[model samples]
Target chain A: MIARNDRLSGFRARLTGAGLVVLVSASALLSTPGSLEGAQAAQEAPDGMALYEAGCASCHGSDGRGAAADRIAFDDPLPDLTDCSFASREPDADWIIVSKAGGPVRGFSDVMPAFAEAFDDDQLQAIMDHIRTFCTDRAWPRGELNLPRPLFTEKAYPEDEWVWTASANAEGPGAIVNELLYEKRFGSRNQVEIALPFGFAEDSSTPASSDGGPASDWGVGLGDIEIGYKRALLHNLRTIFSFGTEVKLPTGDSERGIGSAEFQIEPFLALGQILPGDAFVHLQAGGGLLARGHRESHGTAEHDEDVREAFFHAVLGRTFTSGEFGRSWSPMVEVLASTHLADGAQPQWDLVPQMQVTLNTRQHVMLNVGVRVPLTDADVRSTQFLVYFLWDWFDGGLFDGW
Target chain B: MAGRWGRGPFLPCALGVVAVGIVAAGAAESGAVTGRIVVAEGQVRFAGEPPAGAEIDMSADAYCRDRHDETLMDRPVRVGADGGLADVLVRIVNAPAASASSPAPEAEALLDQEDCLYTPRAVAVRAGQPLVIRNSDATLHNVRVVPDSNPGFNLGQPIQGIQSTRSFETPEIGIQVRCDIHGWMTASIHVLEHEFFDVTGEDGAFTLPTLPPGDYEIEAWHPTLGTVSERVSVAAGETPSLTLEFSSG
Candidate 1:
């Protein structure tokens, strides 16, 4: 009888515990429904304050504000999303959609990636839920139309600054090269640039290499001056025209280098998008005419007198923040594709991948680590690697007047 | 009387607009929503056994804390080698930022590398964030991030007591981050951009805090366990606890 009573007592205790759990759960479940629903969906929300901190805070700032916007010194300015009185005109749903899909159509940076794949629907809702707490005014003012222009705090014209960039790179079977480029942008959408590049390779490796050439030293002496103009096609899109003559002085003594004097006219088109603050993407495409001169004493075989050729190239690039290790840093990547279309010659194709580390928004250092493979059999198949530093002293805002 | 223009057609248009405005205002003011959320703590099992020594963290502790506990679940268990319980990543998949002064709570996962192997073979964090990797052993280790879609980095930490904190700028799920110094040191990083996610503790307990109260989708992630998500209803100032069970095939 005593053992049976002990068993019954234990069973009763378990029942009481289960009952208490049920009662408490019921009470908590009835407390706040809307907020709980919003919170539950928070997992998939990409624009939530928490989400922004984990993904974008290192550069754009924790408060949805940025420091780069203040230093633009342009007539317009970067839009401040946290300005409740101004941003309230935009609907919350619209904001969430834009944040998830990105703002390229709205003239914002492509660097502000589309988070639909990164975040789930619930997490996206959570971010919208958070955004609702601030920037809550959603009524547009009467008779005021939205305008598409670069946001700046000062004037865009009278930009008088010079930027010089130099970079180099080395890899197995690739060239150790250096390049120096300088630029200055004036008020009339016309910019001046000077570029010089030098390269040397020990054992250059192509995709299909049967013979090896070790201790092969190649050097190039190049000088180019160009004038270019950029104009807006639409809100964030632009059209660029560059027509200039480049004079190259061949100085390579070995078989691996070019031994000829050349003149070229390069025309390029570049499209750029600036995100809320410092992040951006620049896509560019261009073609040019290259005219060669013969220098027989320097081992010239391909060109005896004058050879004319045309070349085209395209680049897609992005720049964003990286703060995983320490303070904020900018990291960028660019893919280059080009082809030289000349008569009676197999089209020359080259692919190059480059990585860049930013010292600042205006100054950056680049390292090109990929090898280029040539498809044309008649043209020499040479691999190229590059390391170059780039500086944007003018911020490209000088063309605002044009 | 005839010369005076009567406000006929214009009067009706003005009155109709006023009436519509009043009705819209009334609808906006009277709309109210109510609901509940039950936070289900996910389980972490290693080959049919509980995983011991697991640290679970949630981004927003306020909303889900009442239903969940702060202590690590399955605290006294260890995962077996033959595919039983392993430590899970307890995290908030997505949560909102509070304010400038009042920020979201911070969380961390410390996975040690001992005996030339990763302590926890899997981990998760927000993308574009920093992850600290260390070698607890008295040897050198090279950390190499192998990603398919983004440019990966390879770094060498050649001394003991040296830790390298690397940032992942791109969003890649289920990417492998391994060590070259010790060929056997392998770990996986699952990057999620949101804050409302959690991994199971050894005891199979998890708590999410700072929820604003309402319905939510609670998602549980595991290195080998895949993902399990459920809708939970939570009340304001109240905790609603729940349980999630998983079965293997």
Candidate 2:
């Protein structure tokens, strides 16, 4: 660059390179920004780059790239502002608030000091605008548009995460169901995922035998492994749409009664929408084509062909952060509907009410707990308790940010 | 690159056709017609010794690195061996105010992203004039423009050879343009209210469009260096030549 005189003559340059280093890592941009700062960001933006050099550059570096680990006081990994895929999407308010109130306001490392003493709202806003310039690419969807994940409804945003989910019957026979899901993002709008299901169940028909060393009535085994691919079809500031397909392999033993030994292919479409007041809606609709399975009754085996099922899931929720920028808690309710593709087949409905909370400072790891209560055929279907541990591996290692 | 002419979307193959339609419709850009009313011609030169070249680290992107055999340098301040300053904005700031017949450049200003760099890193255009930003690289790139006066837009161009056309309604100087995917790729779009400006090329030479003879205020702007201004008096008999100098050290 030309040896520009330090006369404070440029707008974006003075405000951006002027020195207010927000050090707002890619994390602030990776997640949705509906918290206190984003919600209250003033529309008018004044110059703010001046404060970053004094308040944040010590650790964030003068260029918005994180300072060297050895140079900073803390050992935490700093956010790279140059990463466009993760840093471009957050609104100016999220970073402004983080800069003013410190990292803790948004569940970030406390090492990031607050700059409220140095600059006002417009100044902070100017710095945020400058900070955003670090990430030039606008193709990646902004993290602020990525709404909270639902228990059953698939979200539209592509992600790099791992989720372990477990469920048990709240009533009747004791059954434990578990699933491990891994999702990987490849390009700007494509993602691939795989899910492994396993479970254990107790047979109420047989009584426990005191003479036996192990209970013969209980069954435990792996179920079906599902592989799927999804591509984001469209996305704006508030809406996202995706189309995907999944194939399930019959890998479990049907006689154990713990797995479905039938191969199936499923196709689905998912959508996520951000509403006012931190509210969100997620919808997933799909169909399943199942292959014939063998069933034994009275020592005779029967096989049926051409089985198909259709399903629809909708989740409605709102996110609330603890005091402006603390841990985020999202309360959501899901409505699920399914039906067999057969004559006179009746549709089954269920309601899943759940809450999702950020568990660490980085806010990459999260937990969601809820119960799926069968709305139809209550006598046969049992209410199940559901819980999941979600890790956004793309953000950091499982134990890195905590 | 499918949107190779500038409406956006790194969309699926199906959407490629829609992008092509948009490009075809907006393909015709009306270029300005210049008249033979030249007032002055000059060269922009460095006032001091040229600075050493700073290499740009293209290792982050293999495609960019593979495209070049040698290293890339960030040449924000380009000074030729003869002392000519490249990429400087030179214009008559007071021509339009004086009611001189100044017209915009007949050709639309085009910014292309090739070899993971913005071709012609610095360009000058008039207000209401169309600026076309194109992606010539095979890899992914998103062009982000956050002008202080105009509405900001961040557009994705995943496909190769795609281009987008946009214009700034208001006049603003030092408008920053960048590629988010490649942080090193940057450009500046200088939008002036009047069409009496031009960016100096390798020789750092710029000639103002025909202007009526009068005392006109002239200004020179460098992206890295600060802005400089000079007063010039034009006579009907002669086309005056002057040197615009930028500070160094």
Point to the candidate with the largest TM-score: 2
Per-residue lDDT for A64-110 in model 1, tens only? 45425332112234445566543433334445554555533223433
Write model 2 residue lDDT over B1-249, tens digit each, in one string: 211111222112221111110001111213211111111113222333333346666665567779776766665655443334566677777765743334554577898888887777788877777788777887656566768998766555544776777788788888888764466677888988776777766455565666667787777777787676677776675455554444433
Cα RMSD for predicted model 1: 32.1
Model 1 bad stretches (over 4 Å)? A1-175, A199-259, A269-287, A290-300, A304-306, A317-320, A323-342, A360-380, A394-402, B1-249
Flag regions of model 2 displaced more than 4 Å: A1-78, A88-94, A104-111, A204-216, A293-303, B1-249
How many backbone overlaps does candidate 1 show? Answer: 84
Can you write out model 1's per-residue Cα lDDT over B112-141, one digit (the tens) per residue?
Answer: 565444655666655655677766654334
Error of 1 at B148 (Å): 44
Q: How well is candidate 1 docked (DockQ)?
A: 0.01
As a whole number from 0 to 100, the lDDT of residue A236 in candidate 1 is 10
What C-alpha lDDT values do all the predictions have?
Answer: 0.37, 0.63
